[model samples]
Target chain A: MSLEVKELFKKYGDKVVVDNVSFSMPGPGVYALLGTNGAGKTTSIRMILGMLEKDGGSVTWEGKPLNFDTCNIGYLAEERGLYPKYSLMDQLRYFGELRGVDRKTVDERIKYWAERLAVEEYIYQKKGKKQQSPDQLSKGNQQKIQFLIAMISDPQLLVLDEPFSGLDPVNTDLLKGLVREQIAAGKYIIMSSHQMEAVEEFCTDITILHRSKVVVSGNLNEIKKASGRVNLRLKVEHDISSFIRDAGVELITEKEYEYVLKVTGDDQANGLLKSLIAAGIPIVKFDLSELSLHEIFVNAVGDEAKEVQE
Target chain B: MNDAENIYSIRGIEKVFLFTVRQTFKNRGYLLSFILFVLVFTLMGPIQYASSQAGRGAAEKSMSKDVEISDVENVFVCDQTGILDESVSDLGSVDGNVSFVSDESVVSDSLGKNDIVIVIKTNETGFIINGIISDSSDISNDTLDVVTSELQSIFDDTRMKKSGISESDIELIYSGVSVDDPVKESDLYVNKDGGKGKENKIQSGSYGLYMLGFAMVVFIVISMSSSYIITSVTEEKQSKLVETLLVSVRPMALLMGKVVGMMSYVVLVIICGAIGSTLSSYLMERFLGIDKSNYGGSSYDFSIFTSFGIVNTLFLVLSILLAFLLFGMVSGLFGSTCNKTEDIQVATGNVMTVAMVGYFSAMVIGFMDNDTVNLLAALIPPFSFFTAPVAFLGGRISGVILAVAYVIQLVVIVIVLRVSAKVYRLLLLNGNTVPGIKSVLESVKGA
Candidate 1:
């Protein structure tokens, strides 16, 4: 069973928001939807989830039209919220109920997630004292609650849209661990984020949107390989700026004795390494790898105006 | 089994319903308002009642005082024609305090102490009786009427005896007669030809029910339900919680559940207010001797059902239910288009205006009892709900008209639900304000 969104399209009057957007998730894994602001990543995801009316396209799960009735879908929206004046447990229970979980199950799930998300204190609160509303909790703690709501249903498919927004590193890592566990349990996840490093760490497949169009998409490694292995990082005890220059490689950055160079191919990188050794500079670290997800994203969607004009 | 297969279940609807109602009461602002309402009505009932009783009591007391004063005052009778010579001896039979006087001076002197003077003179065909008393005295007109009527009856009897009229004939002439009415005004006309035992008399309790019912709808729909629905929807929209919610529940299910939930909360409030007011009035009357039945403006009698009849009572209940549903759903539609809490009023302002128009129009027409206004108001969707009760109670509308109005509302509700579903689907996921009805309609059509 897989999720397939084909030829999806959306528009507002003459302004097209998502044009012919297509992607497929063959099985349980994270599919990263990477894009700059207003690239229609959210719009496409909404259409795929059947939350929005599409201009044209079909979204299917296992060869049948996909809908809330056909598959259990958990969504962590870009703009997260809990009723500011309500208890955290109440809202979580409500969300669970929406997903067809009974009260007993909802209560159980709330307890489990509250403990896992480390929000048990807020949920249980003090017996006599008034329970805290969402607004009373710290921004990070609220984000944790939001995550707990999305996972309370234990859905088979999860869509996280900027799930880790506005979180400190510790909280981010905490949520990331939970997300990794879901994937291990065979949850099909579609994630959209500005944090490319996080995407690179989790997403096996990716679709990079640039101005309502897919500029790059496919297996993450394949897309990175397509971007080419033209970037190199090196560290040495002595200065290697002169060797990099003589080897005809473009010096991108230098800090003390360390240097980053851009190369056309492996030949240039090898020559640079050889020149550095010939110069009697002790090679501390040498690495040749494909483009980082960040670099690839920048390359794909960097020139927004140019891409739109094209 | 996938989650989607069981998504159409009632468990979600039930949860949302319970959550919303609990939240409404749990909200301190709402709870305070409800408490204030109960106190005001409960106290108002007995206070108004007591004042009315006091006024009636004062009038009754004044009447008894005048009777007592009249009983003590001496009645000086001056007989000029001598037709009352025999009757003068028995004047005490007429009133124990009366005395016959032949001198005019005695009659004139008795006026100083608010005493009465009666002079009898012969007219061409009968006796003339004149009564004189102090103008400033607090004498009741009832005493004077009884005195004049009694003298006239005596003169008639004396003349008949002198004319040799038969006693049976005199008895026949003075006997009281009355005609029994078989057809009531309401049964004849308001029932529209459904004669015999089909009277739609507006009982005393019906008015109280109408007043209570109208106030409940206005308060619940305008102040509580509309605000609650608008705020809830706006909050969800602004916070984008709806995006996740829609995945599990349909827009219709979510909205209608809220409508029912908020309505139940309002009903609970109304019931509480009624019980509280009743209990307060009872406690006041029982413990404090307030005599609420005499003082209370309208008795809090539950006999409205027996008075209004089963069919009419059903109409009343249905009208209220339909009104709440129509207004509640309208508020929901408007609420969905809003993107922020502050924008809620702006989004639902026109809808509220429409509701308020119906409410105020009903209030005016309720007292006016205008057939045209009542019929028109009853035909309009929401206005029909508010005005039908007034029209029915005022006898401005017939049974047929009432039924028609109810049917119109039912039809309007179905259509509104359909259109609302479209608007809800579009606006729930929309990131920006819908701006106006034109765009919303366009979106609904497009969807």
Candidate 2:
């Protein structure tokens, strides 16, 4: 089944919030929505989920309007919340029931997720001990509960906004593993986050929004391949500043014996390496790779800004 | 989306309702309030009865002291029922010449202007005690009343003792007398205008009082339930759970669930209160020896139910339900516009204002004694919910008018729900700022 979003638009008075933002998941995989702060990423997600009214848009699942009736969706919102006074178990059950999951199934899912997310202590009560409320647990644990709620119904499509914003290293790894499980299980997922490494690790396609407009969109590998392997990390025992200048490669940064340079393509990098060898510069390490997702995002935003300036 | 989708979107309301109710019962504040309400209502009747009994005893003692200081020179007791002897004359602190006469004629002939003849006679129903004074007696009416009150208190104690009955069992013995059956004043008044005289009908003054009382109760119940609705609705925004919830269920469904959920809690509390009050009343009669029969010979008329029968009562019940739903939905609408818990008081105040207008209008129009204004008030919404039931009971409006008022209220509730559903859906996601009227209106228009 395909999930398609087309010509999504939203505005408030004279301010355009999300302008013609559009993307689709043609198959089961992770599609990333990346943007700067106040970049309307959350707003676009809300419109897609039908939580907010769009000025213009259409979101469909398998050629039907995407709603609860047509699609079983799980959403972990950016502004995370659980009822502070309610029990974690009760809140999960309530959310599960709302998604039309039966009680027995919801209970089984809760038990599974609580263990997988390592939040079983907060959910299950001990002898003579009160059940834990959302407020009583740590923020990370509460987030785990929210994630558990999102997955309680075993939805076909899941949308996560800032899923790893405030997690520690351990919890982050745990969540990432569960996300991999979902991918392996062949579920359609839309993720929005500012963490470039996580996005790069999981996302096959992406749309980068800036100022409520898309600055970059398409397959991740193709976008990187188009930019070519232009990043060169070279380390030599001696200073080769003048030799790097002779090779005509743009030097980006330099430390004691290491040089980070920008090259036009693989030929330029090979030429630099040959020149360094000819100069008797002992190369301790020589690495050439394409731009990372972080660099690509920064360059895309910078280019968009330049175009707007022009 | 189509209308069918919008209408069918409330599929998950049952889950919301159950969760809300369960959580509410689990909440400490609500549970405490419920327990306190039940406790207070359960103790209400016994407390009032005990206080009134104490007050009556103190009043009797004070009046007996006043009688002791009065100028009456003689109290002649002619006991014909044989329940009292000459020692009964010493029961009061009269400080006058006390005499026991063998015949009533002897006391009548010997009675002077400063003397009162206490003659006790047996009757088919009970004993009758007469306090007779000379026609030219110089005693004031206040003095005579005090003396007679003292005598009555003394005789009551003596009669109970003579019958070997305890003070607590007096109410049971007097229960044989059918004084508690309420009788309508209209039934006793002769209809001089061939039964068509409105004046000969139930008095407007009493009806006004009844309507005022009924309106206060309805106002209280609606205000309380509406406050709960408002609080529940605002909680979603405050907790930042609206987005997650909206994905699972529609906005209308969420509002409906919370409203109905809180309402169910309120109804439970009300039922508990009723049970407590009934229990209190029963305990007051059974254990405290305090029954309505002891409150002199005055009759209370529950003529509202008796005069109208079951049909009008059902109409009244339906009107109240519709009114409650209307106000509850309005509360939800206003509450959705709020984004903070602090704004709940303001929302509650707005609801109370609407409720007060209905209550005060019913109270004011109920006393106007104008048929046109009464009929109009009984047919209009808000006011009709408060006034129509009582107006029908008072015979100020006919059953047909009451039915019309019911229909009007139902239509109003439907319209309010429609508008509220749209407003609720629009405003649930409105962030931290509380939206003003213009924004709400705009949202409604867009919806």
Candidate 3:
């Protein structure tokens, strides 16, 4: 059985947010959702999760309507909401019960999560006493609890919207590991994070939302490769405006010791290296590859905006 | 199922439920206040009861342990039938104490001197009495007439002042006659359930307690559930937990879990309060020795309410409680549409309005004692739970009707639960703070 979100669309009085989005999401794997700001990535996720009614099309489990009885899913919104007044253990246990998990198991899971997160000492602290209302926990700790809530149920589908927003690097890595643990165990996770590097490290499949539409999707490597914009970085000795004018690329980031060139779709990358070599330019080094997820997302959004203006 | 899949299944959701309960309790949430409120209320029951309890035989006791009345005296002379007494001169000759003359002419003059003068008159139509009652009287001062002799004589049945009077035809007088009640019947009978052999009286002092307890339960339950629903909803929406929660249990379950959890405290408070009140009432009656029977109970009939009848009524109320559960869940679920805590008040305010309407209806039904209120309340879900009890308490509704009303209430609960569950599922999943009633209603109607 699969989650089928078909041709889903959402609009708010002429401002279309989710545009005819469609995806047959795979079960039990990590799928990164990449997008720039205002890309409607969050909106698309809501439509797919059946939280918002799509203006068009339907979301189904296998072939039936995605009713509550048929499935168990967990979501950690971008906001990382937890009850501030509820103790960490209490909140997690409540989320567990929400999924129909029994009382004993809820307790055991609370202990496990409390211990895992290393906050077991404060498990019984009155939220008021500790001032640990959901609002009280540090961003990272709140994210930890959010993760605990979503993962506590071992949901069939786990949706994480900006899951790593307020997390520090160390905590981010910890979360990364926990997220991987869920994925490796064949637990389906559809996650969106602003941490591009983190997403690159974990995602097998990726979907890029640009202006409420799926601009680029499928395999991460493929989408990056399919961006059709090759990035070439050159270490320059002097201002290479003269050399750059001859050719090489349209997208360019010329920084000290590093000049990034997005060469168009062609085998001209090797020829550019030859031309630079012939010009006697002291190129420190060169790294050639398809566009990064960020670069691809930028280009996708740019192109979509251009299309809208046109 | 394989071990790997079930591990998350068993471990995940279960953890959430217990964690919530623990969270709720640790926060000194509903449980603490509920216990305190109940204890206070229970203690209040006695306070109120002390005022309402009837003045029993103890009221008749005229003498204190340390003192005696030297100027007054009482006698049980069976002279209503005018049997000749050999020592009439001896009664009038008591130096300090005065003797009550049974004759009207003698009684008028000696009324000032006598402590008690009970006259028994036996004519054809049962026995009657014409003895004068004075303000200066003892609680235990009753005219006694236990005649051991078999000879024919006149007797007065003074205590049954309004007996055989058409109960319906009784006038709307301000004052009610005094009657003592031995409330706890060790063995209950189904004989002429109400207004017959025994009727439970609500004493004056206890009246205040009953009213207070009722108000406290009404206001507090609404208060607890109100914030409980609004805050929990807005919190979930704010944190975006609604989506995760909706996936596993249907919005109804999450709503149920929350309100149900809070209600556990409400029930606890009520039980504790009940026990406390019982003990307090006893204490007040013992120590303060206040007689509240002066307030009311000229006419009382618990025949409309029996232990069995109460149980049946209680069964109906349980249905009402179930209805409250749904109401709370729905309120919470609906209120959560707001993305922020600020907007929660409005959503829950609407909920409060609905709850208040039900509470008022219950109070009105309690005082007015109408069948329509009972019938309508039973069908209206939340209102049914409130009004049904009032109807039963007032003895305006029968056990059969109560059962049926509650049964109807129970069905409404199921229906409300199902619908609210739907709304919960749809609305909770979205963390949109501004969706408002339009979206919620659409989801409910759309579903």
Task: Please list the C-alpha lDDT of all candidates, in the order they appear.
Answer: 0.74, 0.80, 0.60
Q: Model 1, range A142-253, lDDT digits (tens) per residue?
A: 7888888888888899999988889999988999999999999999999999888888889999998988998888999887777678889899998767787788888899
Look at candidate 1 and give me any clashing residue pairs.
Answer: A69-B4, B49-B295, B49-B296
Ranking by DockQ: 2, 1, 3
- Scored by lDDT, model 2 comes in at 0.80
User: Candidate 3 lDDT, tens digit per residue, B398-430?
Assistant: 667777776776676666666665566556555
Per-prediction fnat? 0.64, 0.64, 0.51
Which regions of candidate 2 are displaced past 4 Å?
A303-310, B1-8, B58-62, B69-181, B184-193, B196-202, B286-289, B293-307, B435-439
Candidate 1, Cα interface RMSD: 5.0
- Cα lDDT of model 1 by residue, B6-101, tens digit: 222333567678888888888898889778877876777666766666777899888555444335356667767665544443332345466778
DockQ, per-model, please? 0.44, 0.45, 0.29
Model 1 residue runs over 4 Å out of place are A304-310, B1-11, B35-45, B55-100, B107-224, B270-306, B360-382, B387-407, B434-439
Q: A64-183 in candidate 3: lDDT tens per residue?
A: 666445666778877556665555665665567656677698888777877776656556565556444566667777777777777676677778887777878888777777777887
Q: What share of the true interface contacts does candidate 3 keep?
A: 0.51
Query: Model 1 scores what on Cα lDDT?
Result: 0.74
